[model samples]
Target: MDDIKRKYVIPGDVITTGPYRAEENVNLVGDKIIATTVGISEIYDSGVRVIPLTGMYVPRIDDFIIGIVKSHTSLSWELDMRSCYPGILPAQDVFGRDFNPKVDELTSRLKKGDLVAARIANFDRSRDPLITIGDRDLGKIEEGELVKISPSKVPRLIGKRGSMIQTIENATKALITIGQNGYIVVSCEEPEGLLKALDAIRMIDEQAHVPNLTEKIQEMLGSNSE
Candidate 1:
């Protein structure tokens, strides 16, 4: 069987399953075999495997991410979410109001450079990611210094049922708003407090996989204060 399989092996890859000495120009299809043109060869009975040589980012639905507000218009604001395209947050989607309001009021409501907590509402082939701030918790983020991180790391920062956020708040005595797109806004009573909060947030993002991290952070902050 191995010899027969080798006959169909392609030139780029050596036959892993067969040394059949069969005819050339044969192509192996739907078999538990793999061939590599590379010099290395090892015989194994397992199935064919191909490793990916490149990295790719594929966006999906319901991916909580952080984004930066890049521009604003009468109807919506544009956000740079580190994706292939920028996202849009329409005024109606934000306020849940059907009618358009005066330009001044809308501008005052959401200005550029203001970090917003939002979710991916939709996406079309021609348009960018549509974000919505319709939920109660989703909307204008207030009183927090925005810190950016990878969108993939947002789940770690939030933890299970917001445990990580609560831990940071308890430790540094600061308010924190973590946006779905990766925007983190932190506010504290003092500059020192803000710094400590930022450090704690970074630590949480790094150490969130560990169990009992909240307690560990609390202890660390307590020791530093004393």
Candidate 2:
């Protein structure tokens, strides 16, 4: 409810009170909420989330992400979601409506080397991640340059309320789509602006923790303009 979240926290730290909703890698014991991960404690409008400074992608339900569709058979579609384990986009999950996988061309839905914007529907340690694209925001992604960075750096790439990504888009005159899994797609007409945007993203990924990152990014953009 309140944006009054503790910016930085470590394991065993009390991030908030028990009355608040607790996210994954966090525990609500008694009247206090405790952190189980070493990362920044962020309380959003909906709930609280701890962005781990270092860790592999742990698929969570409703996490909007982009993945490269690697393979698919009659039963399942596999995706490379920048995690050690490949995610599974089940036919049942994507075709719960009138659509039938058997009747449709598989490649039309997803193919090898194709990028898709989807959401994690289910995840279990022993099983592969299950994803879905029923939502409007989730679908096949095309015509954008892909940029991969550390999964931990995703939040920094998207500043508070999307200020950071917007800054890059405005300066480069490009449309950038950022996934929570650290996959970014930047589409620009001008090669010069595209390179500048890539450089800015790399800079953000490298120096995310430093203060004045926004100002520094502005400086870089200004120099390019001049």
Candidate 3:
């Protein structure tokens, strides 16, 4: 509940104690809340959770994610969510509510191997996560270079106050779309700038835990005379 400082921690490290609720990747032991993974720990309001350093992507409701269409049935399409469970996008989500499977051909919109920007509409342990791309910002991605990174490192890529991502964008003039599931799409007018931006992103993913990373990224971007 207090303003606990954030810190890097491994499994068994005590994040804090008190009446804080254990959120994720943390365990409640006696009066101490201990981490259950190697990651950064933080306390907010009355909850304590660990942002894991490495792990599979876990779909959470309302999470905006980029998914690859893997397959489809007559009723819905299955997407690779980069998790154990596939994302289900129902036919009605893409078509109107009056959609008829027999009349509305599924492949008329999206087919396998297509990339889509979607949001998790529903999820639980018992059922696969459901995703929807009906919103204004959600749909098939037609252009941009795809880049992947560890899902856990997404927050680090975003940085405090968007400093890290802003740096890369300003330096390279590249547009980057980040997915909570670790999928990224980058677009730039200049080919050289595109490569530079990707290199910077990869650097961040590999060395996120390294201190003074903001400064290091600045240096890397500035080193290019082009």
Backbone clashes in model 3, listed as residue pairs: none
Q: Could you tally the backbone clashes for each prediction?
A: 17, 0, 0
Write the residue-wise lDDT of candidate 1 on 1-226 in tens digits.
Answer: 3522112323455454443322222235444244433212333343343221111223456655556678887777887776777888887876566545663356667777766777787877867878877766777666668786655466667777987777777777888876555567788998877998888777766664467887787787777668
Residues 180-224, candidate 3: write the lDDT tens digits. Answer: 999999999999999999999999999988999999999999998
Kindly provide the TM-score of model 1 when superposed on the true structure, using C-alpha atoms: 0.61
Q: Model 2, range 69-160, lDDT digits (tens) per residue?
A: 89998867899999888988877666665657668666666789999899988888778888888788778887889998888898788898
Report the number of the highest-lDDT candidate: 3
TM-score of each: 0.61, 0.76, 0.90
Residue 129 of model 1: what lDDT?
Answer: 75
Q: Where is model 3 more than 4 Å wrong at Cα?
A: 1-3, 14-20, 43-47
- lDDT pick, better of 2 and 3: 3
What does the lDDT come to for candidate 3?
0.93
Candidate order, lDDT descending = 3, 2, 1
Candidate 3, position 81, lDDT: 74
Estimate candidate 1's alpha-carbon lDDT, on a 0 to 1 scale. 0.63
